[model samples]
Structure formats: C-alpha cells, structure tokens
Target: MTIQENRERPERSGGEQSAAEPSPPDAGGSPAIAVEGLRKQFGSGPEAVTAVEDVSFSVERGSVVGLLGPNGAGKTTTIKSILGMVLSDEGSVRIHGIDVYDEPRRAYAHVDAMLEGARNDYWRLTVRENLRYFSTIGGVDPDSIADRHERLLDKLDLADAADQPVRSLSRGMKQKVSLASVLASEADVVFLDEPTLGLDVESSLTLRRELRRIVAERNLTVVVSSHDMDVIEDICDRVVIMNEGRVIADDSVENLLHGFDARGYRVTSADLDETVVADLRDRFEVTEIERSGDRTRVEVATDSDGFYALTAFLRSRDVTLDAVETVDWDLEDVFVELTRREER
Candidate 1:
C-alpha cells in the first residue's frame, strides 16, 4: 500500500520510462557520501547550543545507511549540513568526492533530498504539477524528464492522484509525491528523512519493502534517517546510531546485535534433583529458580557455547536434556543498550 492507496486517492497509469536514463553506481573507490569531523553549533556565549559534534562516517555506494538517535541526537542537523541547508562550524562534507563547501553547485548536483517529506511539496499544486515543477527547478529540462516523471507516478502508485490538488490529498499521499520526485530524479544520492512518518503499518511496511526493492534494482545510494526502528532494520544495510549530538555506534545491524547480546536463557525440566541443581548453581550464573507442579525452571546467564557444559553437568547427575536456546536482541534493544545513560 502506497500513500495514494492509503488515502483512497485515485489511480492512473503513466507513460513508460526508458531504462537507460539513470545509471548505476560507478565502480570507483570514493564513497557516495563522506563526512569527517562534522561539527555544528547554534548561537554563541554561555547559552550556545551544540547540534552536532565530532560526527564522522562514510557511506558506500549502493548501500542504505540509517541515521538513528533519540530526540536532539543531531540526526537532522548532520543531514542538513551534508545537504548544505545548514553550515557546519567545522569539518568537511563530500558528496561523491566533490567538496560541498568548495563546489556547492557541483556537489549538490549529484544529490536530492526528501527532507520533511510531504511538507516539502506545494499544497496548491497538483501532484503532476509538483513533479514537473521540481524537475524543471532541479536543473533538468521538464520535457526531457517527462517519461521519468510519469514512470515515478506509476511506480509510486501516485498516477491516480497525479491530477489531484496536493491540498486535497492526505499528508501521507503528499509524502509519496515527494518521494516519487526524488526517486525519479537522475541524482546519484538521495537523503530520506522519516519517509514513513505518517504512513499506516501496512503502508509503512509496503514502502519499506518497495524502498529496499528500488535500491537493489537501481543500485542507488540512500541515507535514511528515522525514529522508526523497524523501518531502519527492514531497509538499511548499515546503521549509524547517534545520541546527544554525537555518534554513539556505527556498524551493521547484525554486528551491533551480536555485540549487545547477553545470551541469557531459562530452562525448564521435570526430572531435576537437588544435587544437580546445586552443581548447576555452582557452575553457572543462575539468576533465578522457579518451581511448579513437578517441574523446575532455571534461568542462566550464559551463551549457547555453554549449553554443552550445562548439559554435561545435568547428565552427570542423570538428568534428562530438555531444551537449549540462544537469546536474541532486536535493533531497538541494541539501540536502548547503547544510548542509555551509563553508570560508574
């Protein structure tokens, strides 16, 4: 379900686009986006606010990197600086090896942004009008990109709403239009900030799946920033976690989850004996013990690697093996663990 469908907007088929226009990522060594020592602050004196400090990261071409953080984490500020919407007090931002500060026009030529989503569009204009208008303003001849514009409307399921006034459509529908404009653009890199903010569950999931599909099919480099962890986990190949205007963690989702996993578990068995229980407590960090009708459950703080040791201990006392499983952590859990306050 796309924004149009979510809002019950009409549908219409658009002209087919040529497959030759937008090229895939080049096989070069330079990253699609590079930010080093990015620093930004607002105002001065004792009350000056630091929005981004010491943020640095590089995004590989054809990769989706998620920028995550709690409120005031500098996620938006970092993105704005990269897009040149905000000036950084220090550090450098390079888009496809072109320094934005040195060559704003050339660097921004390869980039397109969908910040603030639907709010970026002109509410009075029809969906098609907005697309063509942006196509003309973004340094591309509207006539030359007509096929591409039509294809975006069709691809994003916005064709039906193409002639509908943006003000009459739902907010989500308008956001779809904004995304369609960026996707149809011939730009090399796209920055999406909270693309799924107002979307429903099914629509959000649908958008996420479509985004992943588009990135794979187009081999486009995308930087997605959102508070939706599920969207990030589902769409991003790597994540750059931030907290309090600084990057707290940067790595692949799998690696972060692995690093934060505690390997805790609970085991229930009916044939337990006091001797074996004592041995189990002595051998492992048993956190809790519970007893029910002819059954006992033991919670152990150990990884799957120690399951064998636990089994051996139980077997030595003639206890039957029941079950063993490794604990798992989702992206949200890892985010909380890394971003939470630390104690001495």
Candidate 2:
C-alpha cells in the first residue's frame, strides 16, 4: 500500500498495523513532540499563578518518554500547553513538527490522548460505540478502523465487555475502555495521563504489560504521565523530569539509575558481629540491616570505591562476605533525588 494512503481506509484490513495508523510519517526526521520556552500563567495581575515556566523538551519518533514531577510541579500545565488544550503566554509547541499553537487540526491529527476524569469517553455509550465515536471525531472513518478496533479490544481484554455501557463498568474497566478508544483513533503518538491510577496491583501490572505490547506492536510513540514509577520504569524509553515548572532532568532511565544507584550496595552473609556492624554505620550510610538466625543482610549507600573499603573493613573484622551485589535505584529513588537536588 502507498504510504500516502490513509491506513484508516476500512477496505484494507489485511495489514498488521491496521489496529492503529502506522507511526506518523517522519517529518524530515523531526521530533514527534516538541516544546520550547513554554510559559503559562493562570490569571492576570499580581494574583496570577505561574503554572509553567521556561519548560522545554523534545520526544523523538517511536520513543515512550515519561513526563514526571511531584504535585504542583507544572507537569499538567506543560502537557496541556503542548496539546493546545490550554494556551501558553509564550513558547512554541509542536506535534509531528507541526506547530500545535498555530495549527491544532494538523498537529492533533497525528495524536491521541487517553486522559483521566472520564472526560475522554461517553458514559452512556457501550465500549464499542465509544471507540467508534472517538474515532469518528478523530477524523477516522469507522469502516476503516473496524478491524483495528477489534484488535485493540482484544488486546486490552475489552472484547467481552465490548457492548457494555461504560457507565456500568468498573473504574478499571472504564480506564481500559478509554485506552482502547485512543488506540482506535489510529494515531501514531498517544499521551496517557495517569493510565494506571487507582488500579489494584494485578490490574496495574496487567495494564502496564498490555500498554507495552500495544506500543511495541503498533510502532507508536507514547508520552505517559503518571505517579506510578513502576509503569514509567517498565515502559518508558526515556524520561523528562520536571520541577517548579522547569525541565530538571532529561535522560534515559538506565542512565538515571546508573548515576544515582552507583552509591548503593547490598551485602549479605552470616553472623555479622556487633563490632563490624558498628564499623559499617560509622563508615557508610546504611539504609537497611537485618539479622535472623545466622544470616545478616546490610544495605548501604556508598560510592563505587566505598564498596571495596567496606569489604576490606568486614574482612579486617573477620566477617566473610557471602554475597555482595550492586543495588539499583528504582525510578522513585531517582525521581526523589533529582527533584530534591532541584529544591535544594
């Protein structure tokens, strides 16, 4: 099929990527989503609240980038500005290299958003109906996306509830429906805000796995915003961390962990004596220590060389190391540490 032909054209449902349009055609290899010097204030005069400030970042094509920050950190505001849902007083926002500020229709055509608050779906409509409705509004012909719709419904485990009213569904089911609706839009880039919020442990894990599957299979780029660091770490290729309305740290998740986790170590062995434990406390920052039966486990924060010194110290005290391993930082640790430094 010609690349120029709309994948949404329903007559040709035989392709692998019909569940969604192929990733947006490259615009001279430009960034998929781009924002620069974005500034937004909520009100006029001295009482105004600055929601975003000097924020800038770019997401390359076919990459899932996490947009993270603490509460009131301007994450939401920055996202809204980029989507053109809220106007910014300054800066440029682009989607697929098309300026969202100046051409919303053209830019948004390549985008899909699965947001919270039930605002993105019709409560009264059945799951399948809502998918079709969203696709229609998104400029997709229903016939064109029928197969893709079925594929998404099956992938999201919504096939059984395809005809059930969203209003009657559980919160988790409704959230899944919202995701299906976005995927049915056949857009290359999707913005998901708090996709795993309020889910049970199993549901969260299921959703995360399904999301990764969809993004990978469809070759889509996703910008996910969520407080669930597990979801971010599991699915995101890179992260753009925010603080006080500014881009604080932007890097790959591996690099972030490597930088912060370099100081972490875990030592496990049997019969750690009081003297050695005391020396450990005095020499390094110990976060965890447990002793049960003959086994003792100590987790500490120290530099790369600090572990060598730690092992030497233990040996000096007749403590034989059974197992020593590097402890990696979870995304939460990296998030907190980076934002903390920004605050300080």
Candidate 3:
C-alpha cells in the first residue's frame, strides 16, 4: 500500500493479529503509558552493546513527566520502543491499557510526537495549512479542530504569520510551528523532544508558560525530553533520570532536590583560621572557604549526621559559631549528583 493509503487505513481486525500479540488491557484502571522490563541491545557476541536494560516506568493520565539523561543513556531507545518505532528485545509497552506492539494503531490513536525540535511538516504548506493537515492525518476532521488550530497559532505567536509558508519562517518560528502542529491534533498523549530548542530566551519562557497552560487545559499526558534542566523543572510533575542504560532516579522534582544527602551547609565562625580550614578539609568535603576580617566562612557538603559531627568537632576546638545556613540546590545539581553516583 502507498504511504497515503496506509495513513488513511483503518485498524486491522480479526485474523490480522500477530502470533506475539499481548493480552488485552484491563477493563478498569490503567496508566496512560506503562513500560515493563524493557531491554534493547545492538550487534552480537562480544561486540554487542546494551543500549537499554530492564528499564521500566509509567505515566499516569494527565501528568507531565520528564525523561532525562546524559549522552548515550538509552533515552531515545526507550522512547522509540514505547512509540512502537523500535521493537525491543524484551518486555512490553502499553498505551491506555492496549499493548503497543500488539496493536500499534489502536495504541497510538490519540498520540502525537515532535521529535528533535521538529515534526515531519510540509515546509511548502502555509502555517495554518500544516496544522489542518496534521490534524486530518491524526484521525481528526480538520473543520472539527479549526478552533484549536486558531488557539494554537495565537498562543504560539504564529497567528500573524499563519498564512505564510513554513519554509519562509525563521528557525525558531518553524520550531514553534512544529509544536503547534502537534498540539493542534488534540492528541491525549504527546512526546516532545527538545521542544524549546532554537527558541530565544523570551520565546523559550513563553513556550514553557503556554505549554503548562495547554497541558492543564487539555489534560495532556506528556513525556518531554530536554537537556534544559530549567525547562524540565518548570514543566514536569516528575522526572525519570537514566545513566549508562539504567534508571538512576525517578521521583518528584521536589524530592529529588531536597531528599538527597548532597545538601551543602555554610557555617561561619569567628575563630577559624588556616589551621581550622585545614582541619575541616581533613574531616569533610569543603567546597568553599572565605576569610573576611576576623570571620571565616566555610561551605561543606554532607548529610545531617555529618553536620552534627561537624558541630561537635567545632565545639571541641572552641570555635564560636556565628551563623549557619543551608545552601539551596536546584534540579541540575540533583541530576548531576544522581548520575555521578551511578557512574561511581
């Protein structure tokens, strides 16, 4: 069949089911996306490399989740396996209760994706035309979603250039146009990879705010992959971080930031000198030390127990504590700490 025919074809039925088809989904209560024991490898024998191994996670309905990793962390492979673009060597992926590998069309009926900051949009088509075209191919009547297209164009700052050809727009404009196309489809589940790439600071902020609003308004279940930690922290309800083909952390952003023992403490004492600083270095990981007049301040990384021990040591040395404060950590720090631990 031609590509056009395949795009327009209805779901295959009855005897068309494959021999490896998974069982039907549960009638009640299932996650929007569920991946279990997913594993994928390349090559063979001693030369083989495992890109992903025993990775599993789930996305609940109407939640925005961030899929994060450093380079070569198997993020792309996991996403492809979930989208049915790459067949996994093991495990299963389910979308809204239906197994993706068993029934791809049905599983992806309400799904859309913008990969690598772009979609397969027709560059020759006008901005509005691309939106309508994508909506049609995504199994929605173009006329039925006209209002959505208009809102998307307006919200994405593409309304003024709606009639212009996509090829005529700037790279950032084109990126926004691609996102508009995906959002125009009214898909329940969306996967956005680097959705803010190529956008300027103002445009990036606009996209982040607008995306959060749109997701809440439409109850979109979204999986976003981006190297921008700020974007992920601002938009995602939870994050799943991977390193070296394994999931190192999966939790709410708040927990990941404050729950780890990686917290740093800034302690100021009036009696600290070069000798005291050296003693601190011997006892703990001192990140910073500053001497101002008669006071010395030191920053140390440690947990609560270590902090207590530090206080005891300070008292033993008769160092009068002037002030102590906790240093705040952001998502990037947490991500680095988690991934570094995995590497160690």
Candidate 4:
C-alpha cells in the first residue's frame, strides 16, 4: 500500500474494541501522548521545506513505541515538535490530555526526554553530582535523592563510575548517565532518541535490557526514535514507520509480518535439469536457483499447500531431492518490501 493509504487507516487499539473503554492510557499502558494531523515546515515562500505532514499516532502510557524511518524522513522533526523544541505549523500535540501548545508547562509536567546528543551535565561535575543537581532542578525531594541516585547508578551499572567527572566518561557511559537522569525523575512518559547510537554491541545489549526492565517495572510510557530495527523489534510493542514526512505503517510487530504473507522454501537436489527448474517456476515464484558442480540449490516462495504440491511433483518425476526447509523472513525484509512498494 501507499504511504498515504497506510496513514489513513485507524491506529490499532491494542486489542481493545472501543476507543472509550477504560484501559491503560498510552503506548505502554496509559494514554500518555496523543498526536493528530501534526505538520511542520522549515522555511518560508519558495525556500520552504515540509518536515512532517499529517502525522497522527497515539502512545499508550507505559508502553515503548518505536518511531522508525530512513534519514531525512522527519522522525526527528516530529520528536522536536512534540517536545516544543520546534513548533508545529498545524495540528495538535497532547500529553496526558493536556495540550502542549496551549499549556506547555502543564502538558510537559510529567514528561522527560533524552534527545539525540543531548548534553545533560556540567563537565566538571562527578556522575553522582550531576544526578544530584538534576534532581534538585527537577524538584525531587532531598530525602529521596540519595536513594534514587544509588538505585539508578546500580541499575545502569554506573555505580563504579559514580565518582568520575562527566567529561572523563566514555560516550556509552555518558549516554547511561543521561538515561539515569531521566529515570531518576520517575517521569510518567519518556522520549528517547537514538539511545543506543554509537555504542558497542555489548553496551547496546546492556542498554536495551535496562530499558526493557524500566518500562516493565515502572509502567512508564516510552516513545523511542531509532534506525536500529533490532532495538525496535526487541523493545517496542508497536512501531510507527514514516517516510517523506508521512506515516507509512503503524502496527504491532506480528501484524506487520503477517501483512507480507510471503513464505519461502529452500530445496537441494542432485542432477537438476532445465525442465525441473521451469516446472518449479511455473508453480511458484523462484527466488534463487544455484547450480554448483553436480548439486543444485533452489529457493522458491510458496505457502504450505503449494510446497506440498512441489514436493509431490518432484517425487513424481523421480527427482532426487536431498533436503528441504522453510525460509524465514525477518523484519528488515518486510520493511524493505513495504517501503519499496510505497516508493513505487
């Protein structure tokens, strides 16, 4: 389907039948963030560039929703507009039913965000000091600050580095600190942009695990923007994919996979001939056919019944089939196919 077509469909109600039913509010569980017909433009007159166009989606309270797209697809612009960093020319943004533009303070009162490359500390301050300072500014009680600090430091695996200065920490370490500050606030909703960018594999895994734990334990709403499909698939319950300033797809991971409905099979045989290849192609979409010396490899797209038919055909022809197995497609494959269809 086209990008416009996909956006026109109703957002999934997270297995709910009615929009009015009492449920957990936002993406996670509560209704934390609701956006409708949001639009933003960068310049005026002939130089104007449209950043986002008619984007609409709701994030439940306490769920992790992923914003995914290629570069220049307006993911960042949508995020900034919601955070009041960039103003939207048209449309509405609501945080827990409070309109952001109408009541910025009240709307963002329970929200905390970690923007991409956001610097959150004084260079000379120690890690513990930075958390303490943020807590003070955030109006966290003095009595609870120490307890919160120790919990975050330990949870983020930053306890050992708590005494070190912010400027002396590695990039991953800095990111962990920034995340700690956000969590320490115990904000109802959290926006994280590229949280695992530039981290090594181990650090990325660690961060993902911590994020999962935080969301599950605290029931906090989370809206995350990232190009990392694995992160999205792993951490987010649903994903909203955008391209050219418009939402292309918004569905659970399973539904998105179901949409493709393409199944593949790999077949290996000996002494395969042109007639056999032609016959298989007539029955199924041939994805690949490779012949190395005497052994041949054949890959085809077919559902269960078609697969059975192909096997029966080969047996009827007395073809020596060595092996057969189903081929599984990942989220990346579905993403490319859907996006390419939209582009066309």
Best by TM-score: 2
Candidate 3 weakest lDDT stretch, 10 residues: 8-17
| Stretch of 10 with least lDDT, candidate 4 | 10-19
Q: Candidate 3 clashing pairs?
A: none
Better candidate number, 1 or 2, judged by lDDT: 2
TM-scores, all candidates, are 0.76, 0.86, 0.81, 0.79
Per-residue accuracy of model 2 over 284-320 as CA lDDT, tens digit each: 8999998878889999998788888888888888788
Residue-by-residue lDDT tens digits, candidate 3, 1-344: 00121422211111122324333344377898999999999989999999999999999888999999998999988987787767899999988888877778667767777778223467788999988877766656789879888988888899999999988999999899888887887577888888888998888898888888888998889999999999999999999999988888999998888786648799998888888889999999999988898899999988778889989988988899999998778999888988888888
User: What is the descending TM-score order?
Assistant: 2, 3, 4, 1
Which sections of candidate 3 miss by over 4 Å?
1-27, 117-119, 267-298, 308-323
Q: Estimate, for each residue in 1-344, the C-alpha lDDT of model 4 and write its tens digit.
A: 00111332211101111223232233333268889999999989999999999999998767899998888889989988888777899999988887778877556655677777556455578888877765554445535758867977887789999999878998888888887877776466788888887777887888788788878888888998987888888898898998889999999888887775447888899946889889888877899999998888999888777888888888987888888887866677777776787899
Q: Provide the overall lDDT of each model, using Cα atoms, as 2-decimal numbers.
A: 0.76, 0.79, 0.82, 0.76
lDDT (Cα, 0-100) at 66 in candidate 1: 94
The TM-score obtained by model 3 is: 0.81
The top-ranked prediction according to lDDT is: 3
Superposing every Cα of model 3 onto the true structure, what RMSD results? 5.8
lDDT of 3 at 35: 92
